[model samples]
Target: MSETNKDDRAALLAEAAGPATELPPGWLEVVSMDMDAQGVARKSDGKVVFIDGALPTEWVSANTHRKKNNWEAASLMAIHRESAQRVRPGCPHFGLHSGACGGCKMQHLHVGAQVAVKQRVLEDNLWHLGKVKAETILRPIEGPAWGYRYRARLSVRYVPKKGEVLVGFHERKSRYIADMQTCKILPPHVDAMLMPLRALIGGLQARDTCPQIELACGDTVTALVLRHLEPLSEGDLARLRAFAAEHGVQWWLQPKGPDTVHLLDADGAEQLAYGLPDFGITMPFKPTDFTQVNSHINRVLVTRALRLLDAGKAERVIDWFCGLGNFTLPIATQAREVLGIEGSEALVARSRENYEKNQAQRPVQQALAATSFVARNLFEMTPEMLVADGVADKWLVDPPREGAFALSKALADLHQARLGAEGAPPLPAGAAHWVPPQRIVYVSCNPATLARDAGLLVHQAGYRCVAAGVVNMFPHTAHVESMAVFERA
Candidate 1:
């Protein structure tokens, strides 16, 4: 073929294979939103596109940058259609701009509507993935939608080209840090200190050495664990001390993993702590403690779990997967006897210390004196262990992401042996029938595990999923925190 003929054909093929370099101005009708909050719309050539920063029912001009088989990803060039529900985000850092904060995705949607969307996400995932449905829905537990986050791990980065240091969350759709002065999701105290953090990190001698900051807020104290890549200089250590004292924050340094974390303040007095004032209990741990991020939701969840347990002077209770005595101490208050079991020996030890702390302060220690804790492989807990532990009348199951599938199944098997008419394996051959709790309140971070565990409780353990509901524990993200009540059928 002639060179000119080949060139013409290649040019034509490239034009057909790639998206048009220029898009004609036209109003794009919006449809539904994707998981990332992008609005789905069609282009001038009838190709569907996902438009960022566009809400449902809103028309916009989208510039396509990437094309997919069924849809193209675009950035909103202009909004031609607006929805009545769309309102200006109160936070200036919100949007799809180059350096916008990625902490919040539903900032454009109203808080009420956010709850509805989360509910829909939860219910849909349950039906689609688990083929299960709850007969009753508990009222969506809601809390302060703004500045409620008490836990966060903020990223830190330094760029020579930008000639600046950034200390915050990553920017939307990018790896660079968000050039943000404040965060709307942080509690007022921490949110107001964003600029101070920037200035503080800038002042530290280990400014570049520090790569992250972990924030943990208890009822009265705010702790920050500076994740340092290099050992801090004496001068840097002093600076951290001053910053902690000046800002009323606790500071810890991590040169390695969590075990290397240590307090930097004078007298080493600054320790991460959370208090359950209702239980008159206090827990002291490192900033790396896996406490709930939303304090309000956790408080409510604990109260509900205890209420469902119905612990009283005569009733015994077991708090499985107890962390820092969150529910164990509270259950100890009402139960005749409470046994809190945990897998992490460190967590179990902390729980025991917390119970001791509770006992030392309260006169009721001598009066109640019913709670004790044990560290065991709860993930592998069997009917023998359950019976050996002396199963209580009520149980609170709070497992991690893997969920308590084995433990739940064992509980079901124990119930079968205890209530079996006769000759039913005789309690694992010589082992007594494992103690079977009358009711179980299961708290789960993963819905699939919860659904699976709930199925076992209902079908095998003779309990019914009486109530289930979602908790917006980690707001503005897809993580669904839910609780379920299982009553004997």
Candidate 2:
């Protein structure tokens, strides 16, 4: 009776308990941080482990959550030795703990250390990926550590069981939304609206149908785009209007795709704009349109790029991938005739409009009439097109994540074609003649792509990497924005 019953009971208990949870092997000292801001540690058996919420030079116990052939992804269980660079996180929702917000990483690391790590990341990418090194590293561009995020896409979900609506970023490593009360990275006013926004959504008849709220903050006004899957009733519209009025915010409703977004109260909405007070330029942009998330860093970055380009009043310059004339308009203030080029015709038109608006407000003294925007598919650039653009003393290239590979290659090809095998006939005059800019300033968001482009500019295009450095555009996050300067050898 005892042996048979005991065996049966043990089997039942084991079945109820499900699979046994495997404990982590042991605590390890964090050696360094990876590109994603995860601490890197090697297990005793030689397998590398990535521990989230752990810093370099810190000893931490971690549980392996995911296993791979070369490395394992782990969650920080306990920090036995903390780094001096560690600090109290600004946002309570930040960390690898349960129900933590995934909005920001590196918040626990000191701001200075974050920038230093980013600089190392940039340099490492340049050397390892492209085998190129800058002659000098420019000083890192730093800005406000908090409340610098002017753009954010906040998720919204209605939980019936909880009888509340959640409005914030997604939970760390989970699809579910984080129950955030306030966001430190967002502007103060927008951060304060989180709870109220949740309440407003909770009161809506189509509360569950509303999925997201996008925030775009300008110099004067903040715009919130609410994505509603179902049709909003009159009552819902009224409530939104009231919220807009009370909070002094503009409300945009997206019925389906981003293209369908429209202002709820157009007349009452204030124009969304940002000012580069240094350049005396103001840029008006749509809420959905791509704009720099940090205005402070952008202003500084633009100033630095222009400084590196070193455009003179009598020198002509070209700005590639110019959006809303952020760099082009400012460059126009210095150069003789600045041409702004973009891939999108709509963006080119918007750049022209922004130029006109700024010009009308404060007349551009140098080359006001010569400052123009042209639409071209920069990604499909050719050597012929490069030669046709005419000679410019300086160039400003700010490409997306894809980088300016085609443009870089075009420059290299144009340089080769002009030489003509040492003894070829002279080229025709005018735009057909290959003339490259003496100086070029490149603004980039992806370090790997930037490195690749830089390699071309240095080895193929006959440009020397004069200087490069990191830009802290998105602080408390792993995003690396940088600028580099090049001069024809």
Candidate 3:
């Protein structure tokens, strides 16, 4: 081809590929952390750059791997100056090093500083997103930083070329599974099983068919649910049974979806349970059920939430989004009557079963007899539905990441309806009269949605943000669990 034609072709290719700006050279000082926990810095020309493995107030050199019009995504190459909060990561598999695991993010940060950053994240979300502030900032609830994770979904891969089976979390920024020998976040006993588990899988006839393993740990028992893409051979089954006996763990198998999970030793399976010794309650749950990852922090969180609720003996409390009666049973111990409401009928049934199991093992106390569970579509709750339930003296809401938007809106709507017109007459006889609870304790896993709901409660429902605090349920990760207390103004 001619030189002119070659030049024209190169220009065409460049245009089609979009902007190919080269990464700016030299080091940059990280100014702050973004919402996703990535360190934020700026290029010489003022374009924002996000760097992983870099902390705020640290000078680092990074290479721009992904470039956009206004920002770039980079990976830390070298650190010139590190922040005081920086510390050696507890897990050897942490950071951007080769064969690093992606299970944890903030392990390099001091444990105390991690909580402070989380508190700041919560406060910032409340003020910026909700336009509300708490009257008091409750001290952060913390627990054992390591060996606290009671649940995990570990990836499984059998690589014939590598001549081994890898069983653990995925590699950082990659789909490949990390070859982890031990995990620091898991319980010590469970962590010790990592290498053995890899060997067990390698020995299985259907090792290539197993894609993942789900771990759930209770107070007395640990269960492992293996996800098999294909049918397991009889030999594979025997191997699993042998491994379970050797490791003292219950083995479950999942052939398809979560609903298809079943115990291998159904007749001899031990009950998986967790205890709330403070409330004299024990909760039994299935391996696939949703439960808190950190039992220690969960207990502390429950205690704090109950304290903030301050339910009296004569008060009737309602627990919203009550899954397996975690908070309901505890509150039932103090309140006159506790009503637990959940969106899933299965969960409601499980809650009732748990309540009965706990009651059967203990004395017939007044609080135990007054507890009840109901199934309701919480996301679709309206003011009318809430009013029909009568007035609750106190409320405990533990909602998922979507937050309690509908519930908060319903309360706001009820408040507005009660106000009505200035000269409005009394309602007709027998009409359902709604009353707001004196206090509400909200547990949230997502700050954005919590702030949104908090705004409604404070501005529209005539409630004040009395106090709010963070719960470090997952210490080394960016998952911010929190609780807030709202009181009638």
What C-alpha lDDT values do all the predictions have? 0.75, 0.85, 0.86
**Where does candidate 3 clash, by residue pair?**
none
TM-score of every prediction relative to native: 0.82, 0.90, 0.91
Predictions ranked by TM-score, top down? 3, 2, 1
Model 1 ranges off by over 4 Å = 1-84, 266-271, 365-368, 413-427, 430-432
Candidate 2 wrong stretches, greater than 4 Å: 1-25, 44-46, 364-369, 418-432
Q: Candidate 2: global Cα-lDDT?
A: 0.85
Preferred candidate (TM-score higher): 1 or 3: 3
lDDT of 3 by residue, 1-489 (tens): 233433332333333333323344688877666556677676655666778888888888998897765567789999888899999988888888887998988998888988988898798778867899999999999999999999999999999999999999999879999989889999999999999999999999899899999999999999999999999999999999999999999999999998899999899678999999889999999999889999999899888999899888899999999999999998988888999999989899999999988878887554373888889989998776787777899999999999999999888876765678354334333334556899999999988789999999998889999999999999888788899999999
Evaluated at residue 309, the lDDT of candidate 1 is: 70
Per-residue CA lDDT of model 2 for 47-105, tens digit only, reads 66678889988988998987765567788989988899999999999987789998888
Candidate 1 steric clashes: 0
Judged by lDDT, which candidate is best?
Answer: 3
Clash counts for the predictions, in order: 0, 0, 0
Ranking by lDDT: 3, 2, 1
